[model samples]
Target: MVDKGGSDTVFRTEERFRQALPDPASMAGWTPRSANAEIEEAPEPAANCGPDADWYCARIARGEANFEAVGEEAQFDLTAFADRSAAQDACRKEKTWSAKYTEAQVPPVPGVDSHAYYRNAGGLDGLNLFMCTGTVVAQVLLEGEGSSLDPATAHSLAQLFASRIHKAAAAQ
Candidate 1:
């Protein structure tokens, strides 16, 4: 998880995070699976996370423990969570990139705390990136027909998204 190290400047609204979303147009031919980019909520804490987690993800992130963990293997810890935060924490660990993907060279993204790149580890088909800037963590996955997204493309996309996050962060 790419969380802010000691900063509290979390992107709590989609509008704020929207400024940091990568423009899909930057990738040639490949189109977004959804018309809009999505936001991921922070790791759920048993105690309310200061101000109720990132509002951007709060609205869209499903609030139930019944959600399935999408990956090569089924997740055992998904069910029976006490609340949304517990479920989200468990779910994040079982996610495809976390559970079934292998690490590759992370692209050089400027002005960010840290970042990582991942590719399908087994039967999966996608390239994933998890990055942090300030108090926000962005999880990016690019998948398409036939073969998974190429490294060159993933690198370019990572840079694109990072630049957006960097720009918005600078303005703040």
Candidate 2:
């Protein structure tokens, strides 16, 4: 889950180990009677996911233990983007690109109407996605030490961060 407070934020998840399941299609002498015969059912939620449990407990109960949150607040300087030219210059210096949007983007946040995306042009490492809601500009940074994440993963991380920021802003 994503957690943002002050200038510190993190998207993280606990590690989990699961046994590999046998592939249904590879099972010997097994065949479906009809294409519609096999109906997939949603897994049941864990017992501790009720309202009485803590947020972590709920997440764990929902089988989201393996999920990882992939952004941090302090990694991106939102104020840097106040001046578009300067931001672009910084991006250039860092071998990155700034993607500004005149229209709304996907992975929508509740309070954000528009946002900017920044990432390494070579797709190595480092990424920032920020949104302005009222006077608050929420920014999320994705830069893992010695690890490079794909654009889709970075966007997902930004979405998670933005959602948290929007929720907190709405509460205030």
Candidate 3:
């Protein structure tokens, strides 16, 4: 497990096999090379046509989809909603969803598990950006996890990480 205390970004793993957790900084495609890394902003392809479409368009127009800085010290704010209604609204606006586990039993965890899974949802070529996140860990699977890692697998990992982090935080 790796914990960035001040940033509150914790990555954990739990398996009966008992392997060491990989370093988050060393994770492939997780770290940015430099402070001057180029930021890219692109429109979401699944265009919505409704009253709220304009609101969504305005958000993208303001470069909300631009890539942010990435580094060991970089902090990615994972905001939590006080209620489901707020969360749903945010999901609708951001085009994201809570990571589902249809293939297996739900794993116990703290906070909320969410994801943005699309076969081809972003960019012109429809690049697949599948990611799953909990309060403790976030995994961005650049290529969709074919059949190797399903939603259940992602959720279970997130749950274990979140549970461990919660326990640690409470102990302090």
lDDT of each: 0.43, 0.32, 0.30
Best by the TM-score measure: 1
Instruction: Give me the overall lDDT of model 2.
Output: 0.32
Q: Which tens-of-lDDT digit does each residue in 1-172 have in candidate 3? A: 1112312322222220011122344234444422211111453322343435422331211100112123112212222222233323444544433233222333433354444342432331112222122222222232221324344544544444344334443442
Candidate 2 lDDT at 152 equals 60
Candidate 1 segments exceeding 4 Å error: 1-8, 24-100, 113-124
Ranking by TM-score: 1, 2, 3
Instruction: List candidate 2 segments past 4 Å from native.
Output: 1-111, 114-124
- lDDT per residue (tens digit) for residues 1-172 in model 1: 4333323344444554555554344444443333333344453443553333433222222111011112211100001223334434433443433544466566645554443445544555656655444444445555433544556655665566667655654556
Give the distance in Å from residue 122's predicted Cα in candidate 3 to where it truly belongs. 7.0
Comparing 2 with 3 on lDDT, the higher-scoring candidate is 2
Clashes of 1: 1
Segments in model 3 whose C-alpha atoms lie over 4 Å from true places: 1-88, 95-118, 121-147, 164-172
Which residue pairs in candidate 3 collide? none
In terms of lDDT, the best-performing candidate is: 1
